[model samples]
Target: MQPTEQPTKTESLKVAVVGTGYVGMGTAVMLASLGHQVVGIDIDQNKIEMLRRGELPIYEPGLEDLLRASQERLRWTGDYASAIPDADVIFICVGTPPLPSGQPNLRYVAEAAQSVARNLNGKLQVVVNKSTVPVGTGDWVSRILEDHALDYSAGRYVVVSNPEFLREGTALHDSLYPDRIVLGSSSPEGIERLRQLYQPLLEQTFTPPEGMPRPANYTLPELVTTSLSSAEMIKYAANAFLALKISFANEIAGLCECVDADIEQVTHGIGCDQRIGHRFLSAGAGWGGSCFGKDTAALINTGSEYGYTMPILRAAVEVNQRQRHLVISKLQRHLHRLQGKRVAVLGMAFKPNTDDLRDAPAHDCIARLMDLGAKVTVHDPVAMPHARREWAHLTYDEAPTAEAALRGADAVILMTEWDEYRALDWDQAVRTMRRRLIIDTRNVLQQLPQHSTVEQVGRTTLHNVPGNEVLAEALA
Candidate 1:
């Protein structure tokens, strides 16, 4: 696969992307690479300035490279008046952070809609809902534009729900090669315009970028057109289902531990059944990111709004929360008491390859460990900078290397499954730690050091040290 240097003039549409976060940034870069002229608009001056200087505000693999590759066709701005007027399509990629009641705070979306409305320049614009919003938000945005925008009688805009399904770490690849493209609106014209805009992706006609090659035997993305509400529901449903899968694995993993069965083997066996394919089944420190947990809660809240109780989704949420606490429980059981204990934590990011720490299991575990009077040190290959910012007030040491975090620690806990953590020298780690105790939460370590005690979630404890038999007897 080779990257394209020049824009292809095949029906290039002028596009404006509002809110240059993960979804917005990826969308803007992808559209430009697909030959559309894209302008990324954001309220954050820092982010806009950074992007304008050919730097990405957020961390995602291959995103900055792809953004640089497609720089000629892409531009970033802080003003809506300059970006939205001449665009053929506008994507609302703003944040919808969860409120205390589990409902998404649509303030950013509302603000973006209002701003886009004020900037409407009488040209027909297909406004897209690229953010994961509650059902009926598409209609709400349309109404907001109708009430606020000038010349409503002139048919200046039509709203469409085009919810993005991009994951944080692999967002750019997901955008370039999506499983499907869903567009929802009452206006057939609005749906058709988006279809045209995504035609290259839908047909897989564009040359694949250098680093991200198209998977062999990969099928073209399915384009699903539906009513506005259904399209919005699809994004929520997909995320909720994936969350359920992970939570379900963790729930069963708890049972596996009790029954002397290995969760890793169990999930592998059931995953081959064809009915339940293998994906998101790895039982670890549960799931955390911008999507799964928030989306599941939103789905449950949406159900409650209509007087329907979604028990399954509620259970998934409960399971995930409980799973994070399991780390604390394991620590307490093995170490007896956490007071005055020095613990080293590896991997602070929710998962690997990105610096996103939103709702990460590591934060909850670290907080509990702190409350229990244990000294904590943390390390991650990429998330350290963000973690330092998020956890500065909380008294915890930040280690530059995994070995530094392991030094002089009573117990080492594997929180995130970064490859760097997976490739640690266990023998040296055992020698460096004050206590020879290791907690493999993610089941990442393939082997353990000789004469060391290792505890894994959903598996039997390994007591390789001679005197550790007493500790095993205590656990028994």
Candidate 2:
């Protein structure tokens, strides 16, 4: 069969996206909204039912409305067999979480591939690995499929490595207007088939969002055909570079503290250089999303496998780990002793806009403070429930607002850079708290109020009180 001609925007193809987590759900909703019939399969029945009712299993800004509108073209199922056989293209978006030793466990991907292979009776199907896997994962998936079934060459079943780069909050928007779509496949037929799958997106035929520029039709670049190994490397390299930028800024922030130089101004001056663009230069409590840490570490481990060392990448990881300690040190300076000091943590989620709290620096900060004997009360706009479940020993505030968490607190530490916390009424919170002390880890307070006291890591001075005299006095 001549590879099906690249379909027009109106022409829809059957697409199956396995795993209904953030990446999978966003992909399914976006493709369905673009006119393709999408079946989102997951083992979790609860998640499937939630998606069936147009409810998003995760908290994303514009996802629920898009899912609701695209309900006609989208379906959710817990049964993988029912979804995989009819799918012209199957996207595996399952998690590839890191083990304790920092190696990616590809158990989910292997299982998904085996399931797809078992159900493939004799139809042509393109399997796209949307999850960020280690190098040569596409070949591993192909091998697993071959082992599961009768003799099948690369023609009947094609595995493509197409990594996703959607941010948690703006996943749908990013999908609709991707910076670029990368399709990594060696087989000519596989490349052509995947191109046809994403042709609607490339042709700019989907309805453009209001006030957004219509995407120009750029001739699709031959699907970026390459060996499976190179394709896997592309995903890791991109994320590692971004993570490196963030760590570099934080390291500069430390320098700013030592020399009393403003890191923000320094970043602004350096960012003007076009070669060093100002993307992830904002210094804060470091990156704690699902992608950067895991992908970067996987890259480092992959280096170990090849008998090479990623010294800079390893330093990036160390700098990120020390960032949380920097916040704790600032707190220690203020209270003199963490024991018996009430620390109100302002945010629990990693960054903002979404409810995911995986590997949040706030957890590290809280645990350290607790170990030092600080009473912790935490609050988040949407992540309170998750935090409560994760850190059950800590106190939780029912009020969704920040002030409620600040009430009766000795000091407040801003961990996550949430917009709501940035817009907090400083004066009111200061009046309510026992001590007017704050450790703005995110450097988001804009201007410190004159009536209140505030100290930012790598910015403010911890003077006026005894350096270690306060702690000595407490001990005496």
Candidate 3:
């Protein structure tokens, strides 16, 4: 056993995580680190091959190391038949991508369940839904399984709703030291089996990886065991609420700028109140990731399905979409028109430390700049390759380094909050660019040379101050 893998009272489970995407790969490695024998199955042969060679298809912090440390207990294969038959616990972590109507396309989820069902043996199995899915999906998976199997009566399986609450960059940390673990199933046997499977994490018995210590005052991970539907709803509710808080903070930020108040100071003041503990209270170029946007839209769609309208969540979604334009507006204030001007956009990955560009705000900002006829160049420390391959429609020059992106640029927009970007020499930026206008969407940087002009989204600066009328005009 590796130093990271400790002895557990719970028997080492034969675990299978379907889909080698961010969530599935993270969960698979995490299970291995907890002393579970894991097989990660995916339809993509290339991805499976990559995993077998100890390579990652995607970027995540501390994941490669964890995968290396735990690969002895982990297996990878493209064939579900080979992977699923012997699995004690199966985690369905496939993508539930958003449809054109904003409802999740559960085709992948259904397909994954069907594939696993055909291979289900007589051994009692726990099928866990680790994908962020709509409510009632557990029952839906059960029905699918029944439909797939002619001998459904032979295989006894329990569908457990256990939504993952992991952030992209910090997935390893979040999975091991989760704020809580939610398991929902009507079957006592299934729930008990899952409870035992997650015993190491729940009891915090596993040793932390090097340089990643348990928080000084970390408490035991709360386990919320409830009905399947409630467990599903909790995932949507949690994401929608976090999205709402970020939107709320951005909404308040607009008011703060017009009134000459700092959003940082205001949020800090409000955050002190225990009722509003500050976490997602950051006002930035809105939010983009695998979660917030899709989850919020799914929640709103769910409401509409039940003949209910969530006005607050709808408003939150609206505000978040508009928040990205604030960067363009700040740019306009500096350079009268975007046409023929060269703009440098820093940070392309949704947030940082991960190469996931799913709905990244930088995408929208750059697309809009392209529409406005601006000659745009971009740079992200890690995500540039994905941006280049996946976003060929976005025909913009990319820089190898942050300084190269800023060289001779008319204006700069800081989208993602990478530490390397935060540590950039502002004086060097001033020396490089033709015009040193910076719009700090994330409010990450602190010090800058006087020659460089900086404007943050949520605060009032002399260069980009907005009066009540300007704020109203912005709304227009």
Candidate 4:
């Protein structure tokens, strides 16, 4: 059903969220802001301690401010017993990292469920599956709870699938004003309870938090209720489709490079067709982060269990991997051999406005460059600290600033499109570099720096290789 024409009021609920990572943290804060009493439960003591001290373990826009505003209604703890017993609603938001077989390892989800089951207060409680799990996971979780919980029965508990569709950087905004909220459960009572819990969000009744105003054209979000399996499939299908769109753009960009066409212009032209939206169509270093790679792999693994093959999804993955190598190949074409060359990488986080480095394209690019005997230095506005801790085993210099990273470099690779990188003083950069070369993988530069050899994928670029002056002159 659609949201009401006027704002609807909902009674506050006692909510407990398991796992204090991205989804869990955001959900806990959102619910608390809606006047619900929320306790964020995580096994990680450090994360719990940080949350209690008004510090955030991860980087997400506007989350810290929201958490601070809702501190009175929110609590953080490492002990599940303290948080789970009195909760009217329990959300399982744990991680499902993939295994070597492409299947999601559900050990954490299983553990969390068992813990919640053992602590149940014998009162009616709605257990929600908010983690992105395989299609049949809702039933599996139900079985686990039944096998462990005391006096477990339909009257005492219900399992609901409520998968999240949050992006890493803009997670909080997406949660508060999502386009739709999908709830799946066999019990009508469970769906009604969640609908009441999300009434403020669905009806846009809650006052907007400071520094996070609602969009001008915003409308109330729809509430979609489905069977447990359909809700699980929705999350995987949505992510796989987005991954496919990015891979499609990259594949087209490769062809654009061959035929002297510009991907920026091509995407813009095609995006106007209405059938294909403009989002996720920009071609550059292919997508990276936790969700796209993990979700796509898990979706493919699900197909294999039923003896089905996903050729299109498999091709999309291959295309994404190829984009990473394309960066190395482009550098080699310009400089011939990378041995002893001073190369600087501009962004390390998989994407801008975040400190997440999982499966980032820059990782593959830096590794290949270092292996080719090139000296590599990397810089990101907020990711350097996390990179130092996670990627310390790799031998690479960490530049304190973008300018510092560019100094004396033979070539520069723009990996992530940060505002600071986009607004860089290219004139100053050209003067300090040993060789004026840039590989604009993100296509973010406004104008190409004069007298510099810049190679951009899917666009005609100048080559400054020795004895290619005639070709350079013609292109200019």
Candidate 5:
């Protein structure tokens, strides 16, 4: 095999990103915007074609415009043979969905690594694992590469772990204006190469794209350079801690419901402490999405596999799952016999701004309501198609208006905190409902609606109270 030249730190090197999922696409665009030539490869030819046509398959705010702007520097292809061999850096941002046993299904990641190895052109490319996988996956990919490498040359390539910390709705924003950049590798050269790749982002040197503007006081994100295992574990541990905070808040919210203390005030008091900080403390439906549940379960499962049990993560998962049913509990108390009752759950997507319905709280809540024989109708501004595919049995409001879903409904539960829901004209919508009742899980609508009885998650007023049990008296 002929020796290939490596890139200098100042050079705009060729970059290849595998899998065009949320993480992959965002990373590719962000890198291209930073002046690196990026070739985004995916197995799905349709997705690649969509990207080629300047049509973004997934929905993230300002991602379409950013993709359009990056077209000059970024190319989309379905062929790994062409994309992998020439790149100076390869980011494996494929999906690592959890298995039945809570271990990550690394089939996609393994396939990507094997193919990258098979297409090795003796380049000193750094293969960075951006997928949130179990700890030690960097070494795992390194071994797989050695087994499948056609060149059989040492020092030609190195594996690094660079886990992504992107939220779904604000993925593009998160990638562009990151809080921190984490790179994990043992090899100094590999680490240096990856660092060079992310140096622009770490330094906040790039001009902001049109739709994605930089914050006025935006500081360059802290760069955390560490071992492969620590990087891998950081992604899991960070997500677990956030999920734990949310679940703990909900647990307190449940106690608040019992004792009639205002959970909003409680969480506010908790957030007032300088040590706790004020983020992820909102008491709401529950934490859901691609990361939280899957990663926490994987962390717990990984610990169990090594003869250690993670009670905190396990309890976090339990609390999040139970938080969904609490909505059902409220519904049961509100309307005792759910049999033949009409119910509508507003906002079907896990969180607002994205159509990703994987492990959404609406799934568990609506299922419980339906199990109690209540006819459940669901509404979401964007997730209807995906929701229909996931829950085909449930009635969906095909119309563009939320009123179509709320018309003559027994009760409405706000699950996802969507802008559309917050902007709704409840004045007229309440007139169409059979009973003007709302179970607001997201805490978006603060004021009392006219001609409606509303029960929010964290507020002082508990639902279905007896005559003598007022909120203030119970709190006292």
Candidate 6:
């Protein structure tokens, strides 16, 4: 291959992004917006058609506008073979959802890699693993390509692990202005090609990083390069530490309940520490969403595979699971029996912004409450459709807002921390509800109205009842 001049703004390269889910679509849209000709390939025909029509399959903020703007640059298709052959880089962004046994199901990723392997036309293509996979997966992909092909050259394909650290709702912003672009490849040429591809970002040419207030994009000095394993570990380690912080806060909240100390005050005092940053320190219903739980679990499982035990991570997972029950325990104390109680759940999606319900704590809470005989009415900003489909037996409400779900409820539980739910008219909701009982599971309601009965897991009142003591008292 001849050395080509550095890509200019007008120049466009053919890029194929396999898997049109959150990560894949966000990448395709961002690359296309940056003047790269991107073809998004997915098995879902409906999703491809939606993308082709400039309609995003997922609910990502600011994505549709970008997709609309990049009309000529971005295209969608279900054909993977054709897309792979005509691409400079093919990114595998398929899902690696965890199995029931807490192991990552990499079937989708392996299948995608195999498909790329089968269509190797001896052209120099950089196969990047955009999906979050286990360590040594890059090596596995390289071997898969070498094993499957009838005729394969030594440097025909270079495997790189460019794990994505995108938050669901603000994925587009995260893509355009990422905290750090990590490129992992053993080959020097592979690294240079990726660097060239992301040169615009590194130079801050296309999008200026100075004084950018995009919530998702935190500007950095330069891209970070490392070995394939280190890059993969960076993703898992970052997520694990964040999950640990959340679980740590929850554990501290439990202790605050024991000694009549308010968890909010405790977190504030400790969060000011520079080393122990205050990013994920908010004590809540528990951490959920696509990343934390699964990644942490995968890390633990990875540790076990190597005959090492991750006790702290195991405890984090346990605490997370227990935090959901903590909400239930609070409700059981106030209402005595959940059977036949008209309970309203404020949010269904794990966190807010995106409609992703994978491993959402609300599901576990709703299922447990239903088993205990509570008639649950759930509502979310954008996840109602997904929730309804997942939990068919439960009733769903699509009112103008959260107040509709809170109306005529025995008690309301704030499951997901949506911004709308945070700024809700508590007084109006208290008055409209059949009962004034409110369990602030996410610790969102820092200040409670005088009229309404508000109970949080880690806060204390002048009445002197500690949160944990109250739980212990109830259990005793």
Q: Taking the tens digit of each residue's C-alpha lDDT, what string does model 2 give over 313-356?
A: 99999999988788888777768887887789988888788888
List the global CA lDDT of all models. 0.88, 0.80, 0.88, 0.90, 0.84, 0.81
Checking candidate 2 for backbone clashes, the offending pairs are none
* Residue range 335-398, candidate 5, lDDT tens digits: 8899999888888888888988888888888778867888877778888877767778754345
Give a tens-digit lDDT track for model 1, residues 1-476: 23233534469999999988878888999999999999999888999889889998878999988889999999888988899889999999999999999999999999999999998988779999999999999999999998999777435599999988887788888988888999998888888899889988887778889989887767878899999999999999999999999999999999988998888888989999999989989898899998998899898898899999999999999999898888888877789899999999998888888898988898988888889999999998998888778877677898989999999999999998888877888888779888888888998866667677787877777777555655454344
Question: What lDDT tens digits, residue by residue, belong to model 3 across residues 1-476?
Answer: 11234555768989999998999999999999989999999989999889999999999988998899998999998888898888899999999889999999999999999999899886788899999999989999999888885467623888999999998888888998888999998988888889889898888888888767887667888889999999999999999999999999999999988997888888989999999989999999998998999999999999999999999999999999899888899889879888999999999999999999999999999999999999999999899988888888986998989999989899989999999998988777667888878889998866555555678867765332334354333323
lDDT of 4 by residue, 208-323 (tens): 88988787778888789999999999999999999999999999999998987778889999999899989999899899998899999999988989999999999999999999
Candidate 3: residue 407 lDDT (0-100): 91
Model 1: weakest 10-residue lDDT segment is 1-10
Q: How many backbone collisions does model 5 have?
A: 0
TM-score of each: 0.95, 0.91, 0.95, 0.96, 0.93, 0.91
Tell me the lDDT of model 3 at 320: 93
By summed lDDT, the worst window of 10 consecutive residues in model 6 runs over 208-217
Identify the leading candidate in terms of TM-score: 4
Worst 10 residues of 4 by lDDT: 467-476
Clashing pairs in 5: none
Clashing pairs in 6: none
Per-candidate clashes, comma-separated: 0, 0, 0, 0, 0, 0
